[model samples]
Target: MHDTERMNSGEIRAGIGLALVFAFRMLGMFMVLPVLATYGMDLADATPALIGLAIGAYGLTQAVLQIPFGMLSDRIGRRPVIYAGLLVFAAGSALAAGADSIWGVIAGRVLQGAGAISAAVMALLSDLTREQHRTKAMAMIGMSIGLSFAVAMVVGPLLTRAFGLSGLFWVTAGMALLGIVLVVALVPKGTGALQHRESVVAGQAIRSTLRNGDLLRLDFGILALHAILMASFVALPLALVERGGLPREEHWWVYLTALLVGFFGMVPFIIYAEKKRRMKRVLGAAVAVLLFCELFFWQFGNSLTMLVIGAVIFFTAFNLLEASLPSLVSKVAPAGGKGTAMGVYATTQFLGAALGGILGGWLYQQGGLGGVFVGCALLCALWLVIAVTMREPPYVTSLRLPLSPTALRDAGLIQRLLAAPGVADAMVVAEEAALYIKVDTQKLDRTSLERLIESAPAMC
Candidate 1:
């Protein structure tokens, strides 16, 4: 492989370091998801609804502040924002660790969500990586989050069983501190922040991004997916212990088994979707699977065998949808608008989590586990409808290349760029001296693009 196509040592270090930082923070947040409903009742004045609120409170603040934090990093620099966010996260964890009531845990969780550093981290990663390697860097962060959630699922129950909820919070706080250390000691400091529109949200693009019908569909899809996930967990732990006849202490194995099965099971489907260009069909099928899982749970929840089977099926669908949504967002987002579209998608996802927590708790309070499963089934049904209706997404990848001053001045730059092999769309931003394009990678002739850039002035 050419040097441009491969990540160098510096890029590798930055990608790994940033991914670890992201994982630590996400692990802290996710560690409470599994154990909170079961262990939280011991807190003073705890109710099912309140427990659900505590489970999802972080998402509320995260949804509200994520975009602003990304914009803030553009002003004050990435590391400073990251440092502040991590400190706040650690403080929230510490506060939760000492809380004696559900309300206190909710407060701590809200504060935890306030840390919101995802955009800043992505921006920093963009600054540290070359354009050719930026997607890989971003993928590393995505994979880390998935791995952390899986780890948290298994670890949360074990920690709660051993040290109770307070100890788990303390551990979460320690993880935040470790993330701070990684940021300081390992993550490479960029010379300065660059405005990589492909990776960082632009303020002016928000309105148009919102107006996009296709992007809105994707945003709604993520919202429904996470909402279902949070709401399911709201009742799943209880179902496992109360209905499945499993001991609370052994809950980790159940999650461990289901998640392992789910992860491996989704791999081939993901390959098929991407390789065969069958994203729409696969997405709809996954949503339909989720609906089936919920119905199965609702009908046969009392049987341990049925619960395990439903869980395996649910996770498989959940993992597949979770993996697919962001890729769809990337494919469907308009040229130069990917970052903003993603911002909206992420915000909607968090809001869904918050809504799911509240909705699950209320349903569980009113009608028990049956109601929770029914509610999720309804959500899946709606999502499946939306998925099936979505237009086929363009099979293309985003690319950013530095434009020479002469190239920026050339009147026909876009026309010539578009005429290049595999270039589906191209835009040149004079202010940034950058060229952003959507290209079909399979057909993209990099050598042709390079030669075009070399003779851009002559082409005009």
Candidate 2:
């Protein structure tokens, strides 16, 4: 039958290249988050509201076009879509860099966001890797994103100080060009459109995913998390400059220290949730902490010490919630619907970013820092109420095991497979000739499962 070897050289190369590509693009977006609110005032016609809109403008286009771009990739090819996206991103960076007015920057940001290739990129990653090693490949991409965020937090201010905003945009443009070269030179071409049940969204699954309460809840969680994040950044940088008496150049220290504290504080809870299967508890607690951080900042933001404390708490919850929401979505999605579920989840996330940017700007204009924090507090409180009712996610992992077309039609065989030790749920996709199984690895018998799969006839 099938080769079940571990990840080989090609898979590793593709994973690393794609991860870098994603990181470069994200870095361009994130590098503005920490300094934009304060430095943006220097632009012509800049206001608190327009600054927020410019900060989040990319996400708006990204949300609207991701799925359509994914569909285009299916028709044309992944590399073409990816190349076009990078080019658009680079052009947008250049436009924003040269802009003299906030409106020009907004246009550039909108163009930058118009390069929506996340779905295409993820699909290409699925094509380049085997199902067994896909999770590890995706993990690499996720790690790259986290690394980009950390680097951007530190580098945003540094770049602003050293090169100015124009320089930062020029650098981002260069990075996007570099990403294009990496794709052209290093990334392997996909064979064709492969139906990766875990990665490619099926149109039919959308309705089902929407109907899933648990998955919907996870969707809302991601939306709220990103919303709070964007909204916070709108006010946070200005607060640091005005209330904490920190210069724009010195802002990185607060971010660096807070990120470190938050990272360290968040690990134990993540481990506990995974090890003990107490995700609801950890998730709820993180939400509560988010609420507390918002209120704490609203009341004591004038003091540097209190501001630092609030940031640490804010990021701790942010990191934890960000990591956990995707895992819960995977767990809650019905078998064969993981890709659709994630597509919806990602859409909600980008929508939140767009909403957050606009709302943060409007609120800041209306009530300054106090208004922004109060709005975020309410968002967190609502999430907390939602989190309290979420069911504890089961301890299970997805496996795409080989299945012949004939066996896929055998309901009796699927029933028997589900009855097997450690097997929690199983659904066979006949078109793909694979069984998407959710199982507890702790009690699974790999040898027996392999034998059963191998024993099936190749044809009807």
The collision pairs in model 1 are: none
- Badly placed stretches (over 4 Å) of model 1 are 1-5
Candidate 1 — worst ten consecutive residues by lDDT sum?
451-460
Instruction: Tell me which residue pairs clash in candidate 2.
Output: none
After TM-score superposition, the amount by which residue 282's alpha carbon in candidate 1 deviates from its true location, in angstroms, is 0.3
In model 1, how many backbone clashes occur? 0
lDDT of 1: 0.89
Model 2 over residues 1-460: C-alpha lDDT tens digits?
A: 2346778888998999999999999999999999889889999999999998998888899899987888788788888999999999999999999998999889999999999888899999999988778899999998898889888999989999999998999999999999999887888877787777788778778888899888888889988888889889999998998899888889999999988888888999999999988999999999999999999989988978888889999988888888889998888777778888888898899888888888899899999999999999999999888888888877788778767666776657777787788787888877778888877778875666777666654554
Q: What's the lDDT for residue 197 in model 1? A: 87
TM-score, cand. 2: 0.96
Residue 301, candidate 2: C-alpha displacement in angstroms? 1.7
TM-score of each: 0.97, 0.96
